[model samples]
Target: MSAGVELDHVTVRFGEFTAVDNATLDIKGGEFFSFLGPSGCGKTTILRTVSGFLDPSEGMVKIGGQNMTGIGPNKRPTALIFQNLALFPLMTVAENITYGLRVRGVDKTARTKKANELLDLIALPGQGDKLMSELSGGQKQRVAIARALAVQPKVLLLDEPLSALDLKLRQHMRSELRSIQRMVGITFIYITHDQGEALTMSDRIAVMSDGVIQQVADGKAVYDDPATSFVASFVGENNPFVGIITRADSSYAVVDTLFGTLRGRNPKGLKVGDKAILFVRPESAKLGTGAADTTFSSKVKSVAFEGNMTHVFLEGVGKKDVTITVGRHSSADIPAQDEIASVTYDVDLGLVLPEGKMARE
Candidate 1:
């Protein structure tokens, strides 16, 4: 059983420094929500605030409609699984799993029974008596999860628990974590700097930078369409073309880049003279279409092939350095070049953003 969480205007301050600046979000019951950002972006600070290990400088942390203010981590209906996990190495897996129950005065038999049931749930049914040191890394991760679940917490907090694993194992663990969340039906709030982990495991992701959330949306939306220049550049690969808004309409704008006038989605409420940026993902850039809205030429600066895909870097056409990603099947076997070549995209494929709108992460 897991509980939903709500952070209303939650702000964390360490003396004069604000770690989390008025962050607000509602995480529904049984949903897997992720806080994703680079280090020192206040993601961990917010997670600590939610677990009651640290109180907010101001604002409220609510679980299941109950205020969590002044509540210690031990007293809250939430269980936090730190990156280290802190499993007792001297104890058997069963003993480690049931340590929380035993400390809470659960009878030995009952604790053992609960431990076995969780081991089974975690797919280690018959390994209860094995020492904690005997399990593999992934298995140890499962045991840690089982231990957290033993308390039947309404909310489970994980602080980058998958960071220590290798790439393949990390990918495997993302699926494991999501499946476990579904089985327990508890709200899971995960903190991670790895975009792949967050994108793979989360129901919704909050993109944070500079102690503020830039966008909170479903994974595809956050990747396919970003709300800000920061999100466009950070969430995934994008070619940011800086320019001034010259011609503006309700649906698109003509940006005056060094390469000349380029039409992009009209950002309404933007004045014609205001400086703005245009974002075009690599996938959106393609071979010339010979049409008015589908042409932009660039001097092919460089190209690199990584077997599955090709990276094309462009420059010299008055436009700044822009990269184009082409899949192996779709990419032509063109040699790397310093010569000029035209690249194109439909006008609708690019997004116009206000200049200097994103604070650094």
Candidate 2:
């Protein structure tokens, strides 16, 4: 029984400081929605506001079309899974999973039955008797999720629950969590700064910056069609060429950059003479000149071969070095150090946006 969540003109202020500034969002029922941003971007504040931990200073909060003005966290139909996962070490796995039921005075037999069912649901069948310390990191994570689901919450809020796990385990849990959410059919509101986690698991993502919602779209849209310069620079690797637009049209813009005059897709509709940045992704950049719209010559500074891709660092693209990613099976010949190379990219793959705040690495 999943429920939709709505925040209408929500604003949360801490005296002179505003944590969330007039953010309006609609999270559909049974959707895996994620709020992604760096720390201090008000993602946690929005989560707390939805969970009834902190009431918005202004505007309305609704759950399943019901206004939650006076409702407390305990009364709300949402369950919050914190980062630390406060499971009691003294209690057995079954006891931890049914602690919420025990607090409501459920019969011992019923609680035990519910615990076994949840253990099975979490894929830890017949492990109810194990202690908390006996379980692995990933197993403990599953138990925490089972405990949260025991109360049958309509909406489940997770605050970076996988941040503590290692890289491989975190990647594994992303799929596991998505599977669990689908099995139970509950609305999942996940908060995370990790782009991989959000992009991998979420049906839709809301990217926030400085207490403001920058863009709300699917993972592909956020990566390929960023609305702001911060988003284009933040979400992935990009080579930004800052210059003034010399020519503009409905679909394309030509910018006079340090390297040379470059053309790219003009989504922002920048007028001629306006300062802009042409962003080209490393993977989209090719070492040799083909039929690409833009081409530049640079000296290869270095080349590093990763397992699957080779990164060729080049100079002469201005103060900042340019990176060209070549796949292992790429047909282009790898250049040695100090060798001049031709870099090319199609205009359709490059983004020309108005100059704005760039994300720090």
Candidate 3:
């Protein structure tokens, strides 16, 4: 059975450098979880700790409520598929898949049966006799997974398994991986730098930056309700507004933006004198009639329409640019530059954030 993973105040240090700062996280049993961050942000370090590949400098790593303080990678009930699919080139598919059993002294018949079972499970039935180099890129990836599954570990640790594939193949593999996890009912802890991959596959995602976790939530929540400026900027495209809180209330707020006064919903718990930033997704802004309660203005500076959607750039009371997305139906013959326009959005769509990493950067 797959097991849940927990890190209680985990920290990893490399001499003077703290590769992974103090972090605490929990992974539910049989859930597909991902650690998502850019390179050098210490996602790999956290994955290593969970797999028992690296000992934590502080705190405990627990799986299924059991502490794994001194266990080695192989000793834990976990299987790690490294970024490089380290399959033995000389071994045939069956041989490579069953190599772990051979080491444990399983007879040839049992090994072959196990290999065939896993080959079918990975959707590559009856291909065990083929050479490792004979498969396509995606097929080779499945073969690597089959080899790992042959061990029947309780948890699977994948380190950017799809990073090496082309874009189409990578997209294909995301669905494939999620399906396999469901079929096997195994917990998957994936580590990747690609936000798209993590958003697509994970049940919950932890966004990390500079060894610290920024936010952990479902894909849509992380994208729509980011907790920090770094998360808002990193998870998806956002137009940022930096302004001091002017008129404030629990239900709404008005900010004196460079373009004009932005009146929108306020995320409660802000004092009158506090400085705030509002983040709006490109899809949230729209070209429409002005309203006293809306957050945008009517003046549009630029408009471009891709085949799929229309991208409108608005220059109003804000120092930075504001962008909005419209459906092709809504894109029909938008007004030209210096023409009268009305840009608006629901007050609830606006967010209030402190000046954060993204603001400083």
Please report, in order, the local distance difference test score of every candidate based on alpha carbons. 0.85, 0.92, 0.83
Candidate 1: C-alpha RMSD to true structure equals: 2.3
Q: For candidate 2, which ten residues in a row score worst on lDDT?
A: 288-297
Looking at model 3, report the run of 10 residues with the lowest lDDT sum: 352-361
Tell me the tens digit of each residue's lDDT in model 1 across 76-147: 998888898888999999998998898899999999889889999999998999998889988999999999
Query: For residues 250-348, could you state the per-residue lDDT of candidate 3 as single tens digits?
Result: 866676665466765565456566777777778877777557546455567788879989877777444655777888777546768766666667667
What would the TM-scores of all predictions be? 0.93, 0.95, 0.91
Judged by TM-score relative to the true structure, which candidate is superior, 2 or 3?
2
Question: Could you give candidate 2's per-residue lDDT for residues 1-361 as a string of tens digits?
Answer: 9999999999999999999999999999999999999999999999999999999999989999999998999999998888888888999999999988998899999998999999998889999999999999889999999999999999999999999899999999999999999999999999999999999999999999989888999999999998888888888889998999999999999999887888999988899999999999999998877543498778889999998999999994546689899999999999999999999998799899999888876
* The best candidate in terms of TM-score: 2
Q: In angstroms, how far off is 98's CA in candidate 1?
A: 1.0
Candidate 1 displacement at residue 29 in angstroms: 0.8
Model 1 worst lDDT run, 10 consecutive residues: 287-296
Candidate 3 error regions (>4 Å): 263-268, 297-302, 314-321, 331-333, 337-342, 359-361
